[model samples]
Target: MQQQAPKAYIIVSNDKNEIQKTSAYTAKTLSSIIKTCLGPRAMQKMVLTKINSIEMSNDGNSILREMDVNHPSARCLIELSRTQDEECGDGTTSVLIFASELLNQIVPHLKTLHPIKVCNILRKAKDICINHLNTIAMEAAESDLINIVTSSVATKLCCVLKLPIPELALRSVQLIKSSIDGRIDVKNDIKIEKILGNFDECEIIEGIILEKEIIHSQMRRSIENPKILILDMPLEYRKGESVTNMEFSNKNDFTRALEIEEEQIHKMCGYIVDTGADIVITEKGISDLALSILYEKQITAIRRIKKSDSNRISKATGATVLNRLEDASPKHLGEAGMFEYVKIGKEYFCKLSKCKNPKAISVILRGPTRDVLTEIERNFMDAVKVARNVLLNPKLVPGGGASEMSMALKLNNSNDKEEKIIFRECGVALKVIPSILSTNSGNGICLDVINELEKKQNKDGPYFGINGITGEISDMKNIVLEPLVVKTQCIKSGFEAVMQILRVDGIIESKSK
Candidate 1:
């Protein structure tokens, strides 16, 4: 019999030797990478790319996505931050810090405690933390919510993408606060566009604008009280899927075939003109022949808009997208108050206005460079997302680590003997966030600040926390605020990810034959 070869594997099976070798190392590794991006004073990292370009970002996901991480356990923590960003849009780094600290506490206890027991204890502690968080949450004032958005934007852009953006975020939240169905749906209702100009020139348009230009220069540039038509099918003759070859015996047959195609195009144009539509926006191309007729009839025709733009046009103008030319009936036609074309520099924008109670709106952003514009767009997205979440939850939490300190104080003082260690550990774990905030802010005596803040939370109230700037504890509720959903989601997502990493003992890799 041939001797069996040894199977290569890593053992982390809740045992001391493996726990330190595998799980603890992963928690420490991931936390070290993302902890620098936690608070307002967190330092920005300059990521050197493969192409030798340098990019700077303080966003947790943006920084994590650029990292060179290979450990499986470390990757699970990355997923935790990603989920937090998707669900809460902010506080991603806080989630990672909380999870890492929780894992750090559980390592020594793994000798006597079963992984399942720890998980159960964490679940209970999470509920306790969440309850305390809700208790401290306050009704959001409109100004407070605006501050939340602005603060989040400032963190992402270092106060460079400020000014009208914060104000724009405020107005946008109000406009998209309540959907027709009375639910939070700002992501769908908002549209963004980038054009060439100064950032100061950017403004919100109450209606949709197509990037497409007029196909015929002879067509009228402005039409008032315009009837808008949205078309999905081509405004020209298209051959069917099956291939067919026609043999023309003489020149007349070929000429007649050409006539037939032109006649079809003309018929399509005539149908559009008969409908009294001032503008025809199509998802497919419009033949030159059709354009000629439409131009002669003084109708504005824009060809080949994206499907997403087409849908918005329908919502704004109430136009039904037709599958066939025959569907262009009065009942199918949509109306808008005004339709016109505007030229900015060399670009043409199809601007629509006076759509009664238009639901979709676009905020055009401009910058001097492509990179500047790209960063501006991302910053705006983060701001808008926070605002939308506030509308949905309608609860505000004190920022500057106030909520964490308060929750930590609450969970540590719990009297449950059975899970006392777990609860206290979770409470202690919460302190790492504020500590990291102080350290990242360049405070060498950061631990002293955390102790002072925790003491203040106990004496003064849950609202007092250290200001990252001055290292002095203050009323965070009055000075700093954040959406309540971000804090709750960080806890909910962080605990689940920590459990998943802890439960893993051995990493088995198989080799293919």
Candidate 2:
């Protein structure tokens, strides 16, 4: 018989004998990168991009997304990181680190057992983990909505603070929520209007709002009794009446047609006057006759609005024009009279309000510098997103280190009849539970402590070893666990992600070979 090509066993295989032996290596490397950033003591990573320069953050998702990865196995871990980012926005590092440890712990057993058998065990264990998580989750007490908001804000404090323990994070959360009497979404709907001179004079409003800037660069510093004109129609000349073939060469006929065009412009100006418009915003350039009429009325005019500068106005003030004004009255303009001009760079502000929606909310965050402000804004927005989800769902479980411990404990005690055989064959897999807890604690001494616990419980029921050492699941009924809520959401998010990943099995092969 011809000698067979050297055979090798690997966990994941692709054609051409390209074995995937790096999952273990990739998981270890990824875990080490994120382990240091665990808990409140975490520090930020300053990432430099090609054009944007740098971003400073300790956030796992930000770090993972910013980092360039080439290894296929590492990319899989990155996908898990993305899943965590999308679900909770925070705890991405925690999720990835936990997953890494879970995969690492299972590697040693792969030597004596088939990869498929390992996978089956893991599948059973994951199901038990989820079921136990559900039980522990039900045991968790309902969290106060206020506490949930406060806790979310607290987690973001490290990223938000400039001098470490900056007080504004708490105060901002309180201020944002104060208007709605603790209702999170209602508080978010409240907008900060503007700072009247200093921070003390800051005002908040509640309604649709916009921050408009001046239209013309040369407009006066301020116009007294400014006429406000709003129009929806174009200012170009209407189609001239079709000229007859004989009239094409006749200069006299051309002159008569020009006069008719001027008359149409005059008619448009008459309509503006009829509507009592003081300032005109038009879709097209004003005809000379219309311009003259506007000057006579002392009505300021801005042209080519949708094209000329609508984007800047929209971004600055967040106001959107719904319709063109036909006949506008002073009172109908509401606060439109309060237009004020302020200059920044080459831009001038002419704040206008149609009195349609009056409320404007501004979130003024105080930090050391502009970069800090940007980072704080990102953190605040992420927190706000998570807070909104909590408000909608209101159910939470332990997350981070706490979640890992809870799940391990639950799995040790989980008494599902169908899994008893696999549980026995696995030979006290629960013995590994304490090790999982120790890995997350980031303390070698804690690992020693867990090892001691495991030694004492080896004689107990097959799955009782981890339970004995890690201690029984206490009644979490009275205590409010903020991370738990985030954790539960994250697990559900992870399950959804895994299901999606499982839907596509095996990578597509290139036909070029």
Candidate 3:
């Protein structure tokens, strides 16, 4: 009995064929879920989360994130959307669609060939497609940014916005770009606020907007050419870091302590007032004594502002945030041409605008409801990100599946039958984008649209693509354009995700007692 040892159990959960089928099935299922959410005619999904939160969106990434999937292949597809979003900020849906179609094309080959062979062929095809894409890319001019951004926003719900969203996005990017004299940071420089109203009221401001009101009612509600002072430290008296007991000799001692606190607050307020600042904004709290002093000096004060908001205020107004009252200086004060306290709906917002060289701005979005506003914000953000990509890369590609069709056609042109056979599947996968676009374009005949695009693409080159709106083959040079980097990243991300699932040969699980 002592010599007989227990045998270990090695459970083979799935073989190679079974694993590939499972992964392919998972990819197809997820892709089917997001395929209808591809183009302008795409339908939205109403997802109910575990916590009973309902999200209605056509965004592939958002929908996938709300889904609770335990399968490894499904997770890979979801992660592919996330990677596409993070890398290019657009094409989240397109990437997943491409991956699913690619997996479908190769699953047949996987039955006869090794997974490594398929992966090698896919890797080679992906590189070739990207190089071809680079050759087909056009240099993006300033005027082209509108088309690029418009193309990105057209597929979202915000396309119904009455305002010129593309121009607003470009203007915001340009405003920040001109002020910084360097590369643009869209997330940090541009702020989006969603308010309940009609879309006509949407506006883009040249400076940041504070969703806060004046701390003191007696303070000025508006100021002209105001000098702003930003503070990181509290204007109230300092308190001990830890609790300590103080034994007062009499009631007079307690009164004297209060007097000292008031004196400290007065000293702090005196420093701010001496700087001739028309507005005081602090990341930390301000005491009543300091508020009264600031109001008495005809200064507007907003306290308990978020640190990020304070930084934005400082950037917009050209002010340096100070932590100490003694360090206040006129040179450190920020200047703005106008400051107004306005009431919108039930909340009051402070707007600072007309800066000499503002580095930050806000886009106020007015929608019919919160959910609609949220979708609009998401769409607008994607537009902003597309604009940023164009600005940073300064390269464009024809949108509406033109690039994909062109690459697919080029990939298919081979003399050797073997090369054609191997790469043709890759080409077919690339064609999935245009196919899905055509299917979602409200066209009854998807195959006919794809056939027309293929013929036109072969003759007219890569600029020929299916018009997502009308499902007609048209030139996408002026109508729709995408950031070249986004298209490249989509192909690369999709290939990587497909290979990740395809290379998995088997699953092993140990039995738990």
TM-score of every model versus the real structure? 0.91, 0.61, 0.91
State model 2's lDDT: 0.48
Candidate maximizing lDDT? 3
lDDT (tens digit, per residue) of candidate 3 on 222-340: 89999999999988888999997888999799999889989888888889889999999989998888888888899899989888888788878999999987989999999998999
Is 1 or 3 the stronger prediction by TM-score? Answer: 3
lDDT by residue (1-513, candidate 2, tens digit) is 565565443334553212223555676797777665554445457788546668777667777777787665567778777876665555576566655555555545444555555455556666766665565453322435445444444435433442222233223333334234544432334332222222222222222223344344444444443445444565657653786343457768878877888877776777667655455655556666666666776566666664323332322233333244344444333224334455422344344433223233334444444555556655655565555455445565532233444455445553665344344433233323344444444445555655555443343311222221223322223223444445655544443332233233244433321
Looking at candidate 1, the ten consecutive residues that score lowest on lDDT are 11-20
Report backbone clashes per prediction. Answer: 1, 15, 0
Q: Model 3: how large is the Cα RMSD against the reference?
A: 3.7
Clashes of 2: 15
Q: After superposing candidate 2 on the true structure, give the runs of residues whose Cα lies further than 4 Å from its correct spot.
A: 1-20, 50-52, 106-150, 153-212, 217-339, 343-370, 398-400, 414-444, 448-480, 483-485, 495-513
lDDT of 2 at 503: 30
Misplaced by over 4 Å in model 3 are 1-14, 49-54, 161-163, 178-181, 248-252, 413-420, 508-513
